[model samples]
Target chain A: GQQVMQIPQYQHVQEGEDFTTYCNSSTTLSNIQWYKQRPGGHPVFLIQLVKSGEVKKQKRLTFQFGEAKKNSSLHITATQTTDVGTYFCAGPPHRFNKFYFGSGTKLNVKP
Target chain B: EAGVAQSPRYKIIEKRQSVAFWCNPISGHATLYWYQQILGQGPKLLIQFQNNGVVDDSQLPKDRFSAERLKGVDSTLKIQPAKLEDSAVYLCASRRVRRDGNYNEQFFGPGTRLTVL
Candidate 1:
């Protein structure tokens, strides 16, 4: 019953363009976490990925992990306007500790 | 090192009335969580604790919700007759348990924004 799906639930982009968001998972994940909720604020913990196909960066923001760890991705380059908000992707369900969230990806950035 | 601490950041009962929310976590951290966020989706675990027992609540909503975290620390969550979809926002998170047992990175508070009218 593990699920974590995310897509372009919403995205605007303009400040400079460039944004990406995608996460998938139905089962299979030992690690995967990323969050950011700005607008009203609350969910903030930005990176975490464990091996598999790992790829992490946090300046212009870039994160990927999927070699069968289910799936994950987050990219944002030129975007600015503080980068707007919403973007979540959590996981857990291999050994399980209870975590499953991913129905976010709202980014707006429009200056 | 003080983070997760929720309260009545905002609330507006109505439907059936009855509310309760409070949390304090982030001292030695023993894992505590409770989420609901429903405006757009994401953040939905209803219950989880590890120190005061209860490791999962299967998504809570036990007839109308309920929670507690006695001696292990502080915690509370109640709903009673509330309805109107129960409104949203009610986050409280805390995590720290990594002596190899793994699992850290949660710290989230400033939530509680119910508005059931």
Candidate 2:
């Protein structure tokens, strides 16, 4: 079984603060995908990073993959109220068939 | 284009009863998956289908949970003799299984929240 662990199980920030969540896995991943789920809502796909040491961005959100492909990080700059949710990173569950999700980092945006 | 569709946004059943969930994947996608999310946890894969065929069901509780994707279209997940711990959100997702593509994002449905008494 593969394990993907996320840190900072909970985070609270003001309307214009910043936040970051880190993900680590016991096994090397061929690819890693990030998702966000609002309170009481299903997960929505955010972005995917495949190459080792790769970095991608969506406006204020930046995603990075470790050089060994065993870890990842998602950083939010000047977070907004819309950024409130739990962020999860997923990889193929067993040798690339299904997917396994991280416990997630719950972000609360304050006004 | 319509997103993945799931029915009966919420359900409450007693233990030992049977319940079923339906999912309609995004148009033209070939891969579908079923996941269960307990309160305060991430989604866990119950099963995955590759166009009407089972790709993975290793994590599914075979004795109580079952899933099918007949004809590679709408899929259903059933939990017979439901247990009290079966209370959770059942999510369905679909993606285009790539043969030569690099990105095949899995689009998830609104999910069916089930509660067992």
DockQ of prediction 2: 0.81
What ranges in model 1 sit over 4 Å off? A1-14, A17-53, A56-61, A65-73, A80-85, A102-108, B1-13, B17-35, B38-41, B46-57, B65-80, B83-85, B89-115
Please state the CAPRI-style docking class of candidate 1. Answer: acceptable
Which residue pairs in candidate 1 have backbone atoms (N, alpha carbon, C) closer than 3 angstroms, thus clashing?
A: none
**Candidate 1, residue A47: CA error in Å?**
14
- List model 2 lDDT by residue over A1-111, tens digit each: 788999999999999999999999988888899999999888998999988999999999999999989999999999999999999999863257658899999999998
iRMS per model in Å: 10.6, 1.2
> Residue B20 in candidate 2 has what lDDT?
98
The per-model DockQ list reads: 0.28, 0.81
**Per-residue C-alpha lDDT of model 1 across residues B1-117, encoded as one tens digit per residue:** 778888988989998989999999989888899999989899899999988999989989899999999987889999999999989999989898788875668889989999999
- Predicted candidate 2 versus true structure: per-residue lDDT over B4-114, tens digit per residue: 999979999999999999999998898999999999999999999989999899899999999999899999999998999999999999998788645468999999999
Q: What is the C-alpha RMSD of each candidate to the true structure, in Å?
A: 14.0, 1.2
